[model samples]
Target: MTERTPTPMDLLDFPGAAELIAAGGVEPPSAEAVDGAWAAVARAAREEERATMPATPPTQLTSRRVRRPRRLLVAAAAVAAIATGAVAYPVLDMGGEPAATASASEFFEGMAEVAEDAPATTPAYWKVRVETDNQDDGKRTDTNYFDREGRVWSVDADGTVHEPPAGEEGKVKKWPVGKKWLTWPQLEKLPTDEKTLAAHFPKDPNTRFDQVTIMLEDSPAGPELRAALFRILADTPGMKLVGDVRDSKGRAGVAVEITQKSWVRLGGGGGGGSEVTLHTRDRYVIAPDTGLLLETTHKTLGKNTTTPADRYTWLEVGPAERVE
Candidate 1:
């Protein structure tokens, strides 16, 4: 009688395989079972062949055991591949450039410091001249003055002082009569009310006036004039105080600068305001000892259709005498 060799399933029981079979699923035998089955089949075949052949030495069977650690190592390698894919996903939309940095507050603070140092004050009498050189017209000069009591006067090219009408003159009755060196402290004591200032200057362009001379009558007080002349400087944006120093006239002074936008009225019709932007690079020399404006130079740009680029050269402050 021939003896049947045991199958791999009979050598070891595998719980997972039995459960899968009960669930109506086809499951392969465990690795160890497959290895044993192959070995048993080989031995049985060898015995059958030996019986039919001449006597020969029985062949030794060798088994190689696969460790559980080696199987785990293979599984870990597969999991690493999946984890690497998850980590390498790209989602950033960077244009491959670094971002720019900026500080608006710091920049504005620096500008304020410069503006505060700008030379400004109410002079007892300001001997100012406005010179213009236009391609379509010949060069012209306009010389004017303002007294301590807010009186306005002008000197013609022939060196003649022209006075306003009696009605307007009464507005500046308390103004200084003769030329004198008026300090800032003295000017500050005078009224700076907008109505009082306008009374001594021309009405705005929108207002009524025939010739530029009539507008120069220095009467009919208006708020626009004060804004154009003094308030604009006092409330200038981006103006800042820099430091103190002595001016060319040997007066202790404060330095200031301004780079900001402002408005001013021109002509005499009570006209609308014109926009002005100034970038004052030079330091304004203000007499610190007397709180008077000494000298300054500023570059200005006008957006008004009637105006153009220009530079204001403030000079003759020290030697010139004030008349209020």
Candidate 2:
């Protein structure tokens, strides 16, 4: 609503802030609170545009401190984009994990920002070499080349080939954005401007969260769209910076986590009268410098315990010339 990127100055807009400043009534934040307050400010910037004492995020919000100087990458619409206030609080679970320290905006900006400062490209096919490791099953890696019309040519590790169904030649695979969906070409056609680009997504934050992950992992989005995708996630609440980490492949990347909470009812006998909370976290490791998603680790956090779930490590991802 403000149509401007919120800044430190916004803190002064707190109802009694001016009075406190005039009366010298406000207490200076100590060292520990500053980091927490800096994080509190970023969260407040997205939620209420008001400051909170004790430097705690709203109960519904779970945030981590990001380092300073998250500059504006896409200056044109970034102002409007960052000002999207009152985004819904997200559902997630966490353990005594490390205090999140990277800024979502900065992390995305780095990735959104390289290939000639991220020059545009229109490759014939979107290529991805990914490994999916299931907890039940083992690991399987495949290199897939996808055309604009939704056809895929996948080659397995042992040299077997997998192609799309015979009858579906020109039909494209549509990825869900929110309630709606978009084909690969439509994804490319999405407006580059952040405000307009953001309008294309649904208001449901969880829907926005999952769909964004899917598209980024699989779609052949261009530089601009790729940048916009990061921007969307940056603005979306619930991302906790896990700081920098190396993927399983030993490639350097920045990692972040998002948690989702659910509950299941027990059935029959002694446990039948009870319910339990299931808190699952999805952690993503992406090479911001090269703008490639390297790995994703899903974990289930229980009473002071963390259990591993599914994991996906991107072996290779880039543009392709053909679906061969």
Candidate 3:
């Protein structure tokens, strides 16, 4: 009779695996959670293989060279461990100072100063490309090209080019821009002063930080706005530099992270609310010379492990060719 491969729990019964899982967290995962996590792992692996399948060849003007980052590999490995019912996350030291050591104000202030003087041009079309990976969603890629005159082109993961729907000539599918969705012009019009910028975003520090991060991460802000955005980040509470490090693409830059905890009322409105602290960390990788954003990653702190919330890495932003 053929022997079946051991599941994470099966391995735990033998030895070593249980200890590792125990070390990963104070409380071991329930059996149901482990099984569900393993299923996710299986699905993720299959999806990854499908993602690697050859697609319709890139256009002559387009290139398919993707510089997947080191952190992405780390996330993938984490998923791999989950297949066996163990999710082990090692300490990630990209060889730099902790978030506490660097100056949040000075770093963004530096980015602001450089960005203020950088050149700006209105391209015929701006293409935004990004790769996103989530603990549940696996990995997906997309490209969005938009022109000043309301033309849009979207390239999906399968290399399918989607255009505007019927009667939606001027409007294509909206970019998957997060919370603070601002177009190029609106972004340019944003207030540069830190105090005014704060007023524009949410009053809640955590929400404001996330909004600012989304703006910086996804928007094709002009040089002036870019500088202003960095300055705004500098002034945010809990924002600090995490020291210089290289991105997955080997682009070296300083990393900054904002760690925030918010007290939430646990009970119903009428009930005396118990305060629960919600923790979130947002990190940004910025090019030292130009102050350009390289990458942004979000994680939620947990008792046992830091949850891999979301990661956004820009692939390109430039003039598109062969516009219809």
Candidate 4:
């Protein structure tokens, strides 16, 4: 009987063959894929060597063998890891959301420049056109008129003047101006350093979100500080761009939003029957060309329901003026 020699297919059926093919490809295989393939080859080599090594062998691989299935398995794994959509697909879901490709960093950086060049004429007051909407309250628009002297006032469509009850008069009224979140002096002192500005944001998700949005649409942070504020928001954790959107005023702009999950207690048991996490999403719209903040909207989503909690629109016509 004639002894048979193993064919090339038998040799290539071992673990290392895929690595050679990948190396010779038009494009180089990824480091991760290469490493994984080599690891598989080493493991198979060790197992084959252990199973068939002779006390004195004619050659190191003279009696070694690799199963067809094992070779195919390792080759498939390496290919999967190296393929465009296989192992790299999970990167899209980082932070439980799609990663931002075109970051807002440049937009904010440019806005900061425009802000720095803005005239710093201190007005006796600052006025903004304000509109708010909710499911229960419907929609209402008002001209928020106020002065640094702490007097607050609002004008309705009929050109009616509304004032706080004399006794309710405080340093700042809560309806509009007070909700602006940052005063002129405070905005002036806002840190431009990215990390510092991010740190200055409140820990509470609602407040942190409100403060940031207000800074964009309504805060007296001026141009430089406003630009810094936009950068801070861009760097905020969990914040992601929601792409293009039109503000309530129908101006085209870019929208970015952040979602936070929190546990809320429901009354049922002696203490509280159970707690469920609620997801709150907030979105902000900014003009892409001019970098002006246009709108901010918030939604609260529960297991089976979504609520449009708050929406605000700000048209930044600077310099507060007395109501006509």
lDDT of candidate 2 at residue 191, scale 0 to 100: 84
What would the per-residue lDDT of candidate 2 be over residues 245-316, giving only the tens digit for each residue?
998788898888888877878777766767878888899998767777889888888887644578899887
What local distance difference test score does each model get?
A: 0.37, 0.64, 0.61, 0.59
Clashing pairs for model 4 are: 115-223, 127-320
Looking at model 2, residue 147 earns an lDDT score of: 79
Over 183-220, each residue of candidate 3 has an lDDT whose tens digit, in order, gives 65566667766667667777655666677666666556
Deviation (Å) of 180 in candidate 1: 27
User: What value does the lDDT take at residue 238 in candidate 4?
Assistant: 58
**What lDDT is obtained when candidate 3 is compared to the true structure?**
0.61
Model 4 bad stretches (over 4 Å): 1-102, 163-168, 171-182, 203-207, 268-271
Worst 10 residues of 4 by lDDT: 84-93
For candidate 4, give the lDDT of residue 255. 81
Using TM-score, give the best candidate's number.
Answer: 2
- Write candidate 4's Cα lDDT for 159-231 as tens digits: 8887644655544622222234444565666676656776777655456656676656765556656666666
Q: Each model's TM-score, in the order given?
A: 0.26, 0.64, 0.58, 0.60
Between candidates 1 and 2, the lDDT winner: 2
Model 1, residue 126: displacement in angstroms?
A: 6.6
Error of 4 at 214 (Å): 2.5
Residue 251, model 1, lDDT: 55
Distance from true location, Cα of 194 in model 2, Å: 2.2
